[model samples]
Target: MAKHLDLEEQEQLDEIKHFWKQYGNAITWVLIAVLGAYAAWNGYQYWQRSQASQAAAMYDEVEKVSREGDADKLQRAFDDMKSRFASTAYAPQAGLLVAKTLYESGKVDGAKAALTWVAEKSADAGYASVGRLRLAGLLMDSKAYDEALKVLDTGMTEEFAALQADRRGDILLAQGKKPEAKEQYLKAFKAFDDRTDYRRLVMVKLNSLGVDPLADAAAPVAADKGAASK
Candidate 1:
């Protein structure tokens, strides 16, 4: 019986050795692949955090130079931020700050350049819309009416719809396109909420164009009702 038990133990040992010989390399490779992936993910997360930290530091420098009203320093700092961290939110925010400072310092061309960069390259859609709107205003001021219209033609987020329409109306009026201006103003009027002071301003613009927005709306409904009765 003892000899039989020894033979049984040796058989089990032989089976274990056979299993390891068949699958050992594949199991080892699977473990290594999983660990390597985990390590790579951790490395990527660390790199992203490091990038954000560095970008935040540079953005602080931009805000400081802007507040000092130093155009050259502001420009240099903004250039550095854009070069190194354009993917970060802080880069576009710095662009806006630098543009404002440049404009205040009588650097119209510099301001426009910075605004154009933001409009063209910002990662955030909202920032891009703001950049386009401000750049359009500057273009209008320069009497680049066609260029301004082209900038406004770039689509904006829903929140800026009313403001963009109003801006378009202003440009059309400048171009002496009174009928088109009134049409855009009406669109602005409808887009704005009733409680907003901006809506009242839009009404004033409509009135200037000899169209009362409220009356125009009612006239359409009245015409529809009359047609139905007939």
Candidate 2:
């Protein structure tokens, strides 16, 4: 019985050896690939985190210089960050800040150039929208009415609808289209929440056009009641 048990054990050992000889290299390679992929994924995540952290620090630097309103320092830092980390979210945000600084410093053309870059190159839609909106405002200030309208015609989000309408109304008013301007003001007024002081401002615009939108809305009802009385 002892001999038989030894023979059985030896046979099992030989079978295991044969199995290892056949699949050992393949199993080793599979484990290597899996571990290599996991390591690479971890490395990539760490690299992205490091890059974003660096970009965030650069953005803070931009903000500090921007607050000082030093155009030269602001431009230098903006150029550095834009060149080094253009793909980061902080880049476009920094661009907007720098553009605003330039605008406040009476650098109109420089501000427009910065805003155009952000409008065209920003990866984030919200930043891009802000760039377009600001550019439109500037163009309107310059009396570049067609360009301003073009900027606004490019699909604004719901949050921007009222501002867009307000701008459009201003452009139309400038062009001597009182009826169209009144329509835009009405849209803006209705689109805005009551709490927005902008709504009262829109009301002022409507009054200027001699078309009280609320009165126009109630006129039909008043006419219906008059007909019923007749």
Candidate 3:
């Protein structure tokens, strides 16, 4: 029984050796490929983390300069960040801050330039939309009616549609396009929930233009109030 067990063990050992000899290179290559991929992924994650940390530090400087209302310093720092870290979200965020500071400081041209960069270069749709909205406001204030309309022509997101419509109405009103303005106001009013007081403001604007949406609904109530007063 001992001899039989020894022969069986020897056969198993030989079988394992033959298997390794046949598949050794393939097994080694497969392991190397898997390990190589894992190492590359780890390196990529580390690089991304390092870049984000550096960009965040620069963003702090940009925010500080903006809060201090130093337009020149803020512009310089913003240029540095955009040149070195334009792909980061912080770059566009810094641009927005710089634009706001410039706008508040009565630097309309500088503010427009910063906002244009954000509108053109920002990878985030939300940031781009914000830049466009603000730029449109500045253009509207300057009576660049057509340019303001173009800025708002980007087709706003659902969250911004009502505000965009309101702004568009203002621009049209400035251009003396009263009918277009009224239509935009009606769209804005319908876009908002009935419970929102903002909707009431839009309705009032429409009413001022001789298009009273609530008039039919309020007619009976107005009559009742009149009867009570009488």
Candidate 4:
């Protein structure tokens, strides 16, 4: 019986050895691939955190230079941030800050350049929209009406729809297209909430164009009521 038990144990051991011999290399490679993937993912996470930390520090530098109102320093800081961290949110933000400082310092061309860069290259749509709006204003001030219109025609966030329409109206008014300007202003007037003072300003614009938004709104209702009576 002891001999039989020994034989049984040896047979089990031989079976395990045969299985290991057949599948050992494949199992080892599969484990290595899994562990390598985990390590690569961890490394990628660390690299992203490091990049964000560096970008935040650079953005702080840009903010500091911007507050000092030093155009040269602001430009340098912004350039560095753009070159090194263009993928980060801070890059476009820094560009906007630098543009504001440049514009305030009477550097119109430089301000436009910075704004153009942000408008064209910003990954965030919101930042791009802001860049386009400000750039359009600058273009409008320069009497580049066609260019300003082109900028305003770009895609924007829904929240900026009313503001963009107003801007388009301003551009059209500058170009002496009163009818088209009035149409845009009407769109803007209706887009704004009644409770907001902005809507009142829009109303003033509509009135200046010889069109009363309130009257127009009432006209349809009055016509509907007349039809109902008839």
Find the candidate with the highest TM-score and give its number: 4
Better-scoring candidate (lDDT), 1 or 3: 1
lDDT for each residue of candidate 1 in 113-188, tens digit (9 for 90 to 100):
9999989999988998899889998889899999999998875788899989999998999999999998889999
Better of 2 and 4 by TM-score: 4
Write out the backbone clash pairs for model 2: none
Flag the better candidate by TM-score, 1 or 2.
1
Off by over 4 Å in 4: 1-27
Total clashes for model 4? 0
Order by TM-score, highest first? 4, 1, 3, 2
Candidate 4 lDDT tens digits, 43-115: 9999989999999999998888888988888888888898889988988898898888899899999999999
| Model 3 lDDT tens row, 81-189 | 9999888898889888888899899999999999888888887778888888888999999999999999889845678888789889889988999999998997888
Q: What would the per-residue lDDT of candidate 2 be over residues 86-113, giving only the tens digit for each residue?
A: 8889988998888899999999888888
Candidates in order, TM-scores: namely 0.85, 0.78, 0.80, 0.87
Question: How many clashing pairs does model 1 include?
Answer: 0
Q: How many backbone clashes does candidate 3 have?
A: 0
Score residue 38 of candidate 1 by CA lDDT. Answer: 100
Instruction: Give candidates' CA RMSD values in order.
Output: 2.7, 3.7, 5.2, 2.4
lDDT of each: 0.91, 0.88, 0.88, 0.92
